[model samples]
Target: MSAFEHSSYPEVAKLTIPDVSVAALDMGCLPPVLKRFVEDGAMRMQAPVDFIVVAALCSVGAAIGTSIRVQPKAMDTRYQIVPTLWGAIIGDPSSMKSPSISFALNPIQSLEGEMRIGHKNAELEYKANKKIFDMKLKQVEA
Candidate 1:
């Protein structure tokens, strides 16, 4: 099993987002701004498994169930941030955990029986912040 898996554009690329970020409270050095954002409701933390982040500016792609493979672009080796990612090469819908779509990539492979906001062909814009990245695996039809 790989360390980081995610869903994103460019389905043909394969990337491993580095899960290494300096601690937020490392006062001696640059603050863990990312952790602060996750703590202060400004940003978010990573979820379990191939969960999608249809809510944030950059959505993560995980190859779980019936999903696509996102190829990773080369690293820039400059910017320093939490969860550094190698930009995807191609955008693939398989990266998104669509309940309607089905695949088998690992120990977890099951069909998405129903369609909801955050699952399958679903997405949502939060009532508080009208951001496209506020996607979740729980959505109800209007």
Candidate 2:
């Protein structure tokens, strides 16, 4: 029971996500969760939902239902959710415009990934800074 751990301390803030491996995706193997299904002889996302919080939770839920094990790096939760919502909307190519299927998507630029989704760190900063597009104005004697 340390003084710092207590919520009463003004400096102490609650962690949005605990240090746990969530949203781990295995791109190598066949997707066991979502399998093709015959909806009026049309193949569609049947089992493992990806966009989230709709008919099937995993595909659309905020919580990490499926194991998305990839690189150990910080990623933008907001940016990541965009693709999920898009996938759900387009997963079934021939389906009617199911407006009830509520999902959100907005543009996101990969600034870097540690500080604010995509702002290059020191190592990457050095590489990016290497290409400065500034032109120096030479001083001429008047």
- The local distance difference test score of each candidate is 0.32, 0.35
lDDT of 2 by residue, 43-138 (tens): 233322333223333333333433443333366444332223223334555343242232211111121133463443665776666544222222
Candidate 2 positional error at 63, Å: 4.1
Point out the worst 10-residue segment of candidate 1 by lDDT: 99-108
**Top candidate (lDDT):** 2
TM-score of each: 0.13, 0.19
Error of 1 at 131 (Å): 39
Give the clash count for model 1.
33
Q: RMSD for each model, in Å, please?
A: 21.4, 19.5
